[model samples]
Target: MYKLMASLLLGTSLTCAAAAAPANAKPYEHVLLISVDGLHAVDLANYVANHPQSTMASLQKTGVFYPNAVTTNPSDSFPGLVAQVTGGTPAVTGVYYDDSFDRSYFAADSKCQGNPGIEVNFAESIDIDDTRLDAGGTPGKPMTQIDPAKLPRMLVKGECKPVFPHDFVRVNNVFEVVHQHGGRTAWSDKHPAYEWLNGPSGTGVDDLYALEQDSLIPGSKVKTTGSFKAEREFDAAHVKAVINEIKGFDSTGANKQPVPALFGLNLQAVSVGQKLPKAGPGDDAGLIGGYADANGMPNSGLAVQLDFVDHALGELVGALHDSKLDDTTLVVIASKHGQSPIDPSKFQPTDEDPYTKMPGYAFHIADDASLIWLKPEERAKALTAATEYLKDQGKALGIGQLLTSNQVALAYQDPASDTRAPDFIVTVNPGVVYTGGKKIAEHGGSNANDRNVALLLSNPSIPPRTITALVQTTQVAPTVLQALGYDPKELQAVQKEATQALPGTPF
Candidate 1:
């Protein structure tokens, strides 16, 4: 009888102990997401198979690589980044383009006022009266400039007052979730307009390094004459700043005392001005001269870019290793969009072509889209002519579909606001290269080639393999959440099912 009682008691204790043990004890201590804008899955595969010296190549040997990672619709930087951070689509988040018309309630015009798409600047600084704008503003005082007292009334229904990170995102981002769970967050990037994505506050990023101010030398002959060269020094400085911040966190005991749950280092060099010459060819030398001769490929300016980006990646990876955070950190390398080949012969000023003529036509090949401003009197005529021209070009050049004002408006959920859409929005097709002068690359459209980019994840927790599944940029945020053992569903804005949870992660 004594032996039987002892055996029963011991068995019960063993059962309890087993139940108390964690199912999976390994946890990711940190996450470092890097965006190498314009990187394609094919490029990554080539690098890995060829044993290239790119930092990404080194990571591919042991990391999980996705060869067909797609981005959300509109496929521009704003939407791409939002998807990556919020795990939601454009229909949910409302960041449809680099510059979207303000569709929130307006007080002055009881009727919705359609803004001119070309004139709407995402990076422009505009003054707003919170009260009037919030109240939908009074007649004659448009919502763009409203009084502060009426702010309370104009708030959008079912929407929280814009808060950083959260306001920009319709759903909660990884940082918000991590921070809510008692984790720290930080990020560094080049887009100044990112401030508005989550509103002015509550972005959840404790440390933000954005290049808001243009460092271009004003009135300098180089800039004025369009002779500016890609500045590697500027790129290096941005990287160094990120490294310094990381070091600060480690040295100040921040890493030791509740280390950051999430952090990101954005290297803009790879995507900086698609037309800019890659590093090492010499300032003022065209991109063709930089890598065309050595790579045996057409002077497309991609090789130089690849080499430049690889160097920057190496520097960043080295920094992570030096900090002793490589193994425990989950790193993601991706791009917002891919570049379009630019043929130098396609160089014709807007003034030179009757169809392309428009006011404020600034042709910076590096910009994703060509911005055209038309005089009010010429708006109608210009719109029609441009539409016809684009259609003809689409057929002739084999570029992707050209969006009419109606299509653009319908896509935005407001067809009446078609006037606010770009007079002529051309969605360039894959392999249809546009070139002017010595510039050889460009991006900005809704084409599949431009939308599909690279997404690589490397960490001990993730199994070494390749996922050929169709994944959108929005899935990135939720995947990160799952890796950290958090439920993405808890966030009101994360509508996408967290389907991409990496190997070993509990969904």
Candidate 2:
């Protein structure tokens, strides 16, 4: 069966050149954008250096490797992923975190009444049944699986209307631009709530396969969140989807479809490998999965996960070659965020709840960092009190820098004006996770470990070189648009923020 598929792909490749002409006559016909969650830039550097025979090493010989790339502030998955696709930060995208609070929206049960400080949750909980593999939808069409009752609501002319994930975004993304300009687009992610990738128009991705990551493993009591082995299987399902799309079929492989001009998926195995501890969750063996030392060297379990991701990359590359899309396809490998506390010995988990006592505190999101929002009426006075309290208790709370609303306004919009901005942004000391979970590492902070992620742009026409100049994941949006011969200025946030394509690209 495998031999027949390869032969068929080879034949398809023979004719792909004539059939794969771009609408704008661009150099590249397709873009394979991949995000390996929790992959750090240093991790890529070490892996390539250590495994010279690996697929990443092969790409390094022809790819532009950005070693100093950083993600957005409040480096949670929602903002980090939006940065790469929209070329915007929270100020423009209006997405601080997946579970952050929004003062302009109403709670799920508000029904257009009462106060309007809604907890915006765009995670697996939005799925009709997050524990199922398909997220309570048919295999080929998962976008419809989002439960309207679980989404945030807004008063639309005296009537309460659910705000879908896509509608929550404030700007356009690369997927929207590409799809609007006569290109097929597809993406596979971990949750049905990832429909936000479709952009505000809700027409960016033609085929979106968002399988719930927390779904229960078949014949097992454990969820993928609690098992590294199940996590691999989850990743494999999405990988198989991408492979099917490579072979000119939909993600389900049951129907024929055009190969998407822009398509990719996110991998979660490496992330699970980083957070899971020795003999934790499903690991029967006592092998730990984090760094052995502070220098960022992977231990036995982490090394295995890295190997698995690399092997998956090889398979994707092989599929492209078999289908003859390798030359005309630009492969971009990046990460939404990276895990922190690489040195497990520095791990410090605290059960501190420092923000709830602050004057007029309405809500707070605390991970490695803390984002607090206060009632609007009391914000002015409460902000000052909270800053002083945080400073006075800095040592006890592991507060590194207490970014008052004034300081936060320097990078993002002023919380006084932006309904979604957090009144206080707190960066914590290294190795401090707010939750007392068994995981040794976490993200969602402004520290180096959480922000510095892997970024690589590989193509047949680009020269291989390492660019250490500081760049950002937001630059990826314009870079991808330019690669496809579209004007970067077409993106609203790119125009508003003056975002530029990544340097060192020949285009």
Candidate 3:
């Protein structure tokens, strides 16, 4: 009918336009990938539209912007990040969240004995002492700082072996493929647990710098993520490491090393701005963060963070130009996830009391999203009770939809087959955060605000064009490999999942 004809015409036009786009003559020598967590596609469009002279705006002039980039389901940091690097979902990557329960492992302190289920925590907790910036490790290397005793254990050849973050990942990542090809790679992030970026190889990143974000701010009585000021101070360390890497120096700047072919860092300031209830401890103490309206206009507090990030980006780009690598380097900006309840007024902090009261509930992780695991012996009885509770009290509990048996199987691997799969995946009403925390916004939900993030690819030779077709951030993996002149099939996950590069480009 008319709709089908219109769709065909639209497809034809898009194909012609893509065919007309210029192809790259040679691959870039370097790729700088940045993840500005909690940055929404709307935020990027709004910021650039309002600040025409901003660094993002300048990059957009030559960048291919995908305004409809969707992140992973559950939209938690770990899975979202894995998707970007491995071109796969949790079903293939086997990473559900930074904190998730796994039935295959033993407890962190269990020495591979007793119960088989363990809480897989790959966050600040793995640090020897999370309160210290060095995490009680040597001055320069953060991955070594991880406390083995804090990691989950698995029995291997009659010996108990601690599962490092890298070992938990199920698939090889972009870093692994690049490293295998002799391309130097480096990354900086907020936690030693991010060493998981090394993929299954455990030697993907030549240089990995991680400063714990939960560490105390020097001269202040606040954690790095406790306030906007502390978060900026924490991000500055990673930014410095990035600049040094761009100059062909090691993250510490004391050692001489070849410039990594792939290097990047994540920015935490904007995420804090979106979630923090107040600005900071000093003069900005009383100011609130989040947005002014549902239209995604940032408030004064969030605006301050945005401005800081834009300036930092300018510094990075300036360094690229000064190093004469701008022309040969491909710069990609993306976010792992986006925060919900942009209209701060919609935020509702609920508790897990009701769900816990269900007959067979054993454990659950309820953030903005909910994952429930029940006792296997009592699962049938528990599921019935829980279903009735949601049906009767869903409105008061801020419940939107409950995916129990068949529904969960349709979206992912069946719970009956996958022990890691939650028996119930509960998606709440928009803006309903399942926690006792004071933050106005949260991620890790099924809502659009949680999954739609900004994605941009910029190179001096690439033309500026906004791609409106819906794409997943998972495409970033193959796209990056293509930009570096490598076959995307080199990535195991890319081959397993059939992930393709983003359209509108010839790589």
Relative to the true structure, how large is the alpha-carbon lDDT of every model?
A: 0.50, 0.83, 0.80
Model 3's number of clashes is 0
Better of 1 and 3 by TM-score: 3
Per-candidate total of colliding backbone pairs: 22, 0, 0
TM-score per candidate, chains pooled: 0.67, 0.93, 0.92
Tens-place lDDT per residue, model 3, 1-507, is: 563232211111111111112224437889999999999999999999999999999999998999978888778888888888988777677777778867667877787777576567798899999989888885357656899888888889988899999998889988888899899999998888988988888888889999888888777877887778778777878888988988989998878888888889999999999988776655286667899999999987789889888988888899999999999889999999999988877888887455777766667777788777776556667777866765787787788888775666666667666767777777788899976776788888778788879999998788899998877777888788888877777777676667778887636
RMSD of 2: 9.1
Candidate 1 residue-wise lDDT, 1-507, digit = tens: 563232211111111111111214325777778887766666667656665656777787558787767665556676677768776555455555654443233323232234312223343233232111112222112223322222211245543232222343455567777777777776665433344433323656655544432333334423211222334444554566556545655312234334456777555444544445432323445443212331223233455456666787777678778877777777788777765443334322121122333332312121333323344445555667655655665554444555465655544433234333343445444444444434445555444446667888886445578877555566677667765667756544454333344332322
Specify the poorest-scoring 10-residue window by lDDT in model 2: 11-20
Return whichever of 1 and 2 wins on TM-score.
Answer: 2
Query: Cα RMSDs of all predictions?
Result: 13.7, 9.1, 4.5
- Candidate 1 accuracy as TM-score: 0.67
Candidate 1, 245: how far from true, in Å? Answer: 3.5
Ranking by lDDT: 2, 3, 1
lDDT: worst 10-residue window of model 1: 11-20
Return whichever of 1 and 3 wins on lDDT: 3
Instruction: Assess candidate 2 and give its lDDT.
Output: 0.83
Q: What shift in Å separates residue 372 of candidate 3 from its native position after superposition?
A: 1.8
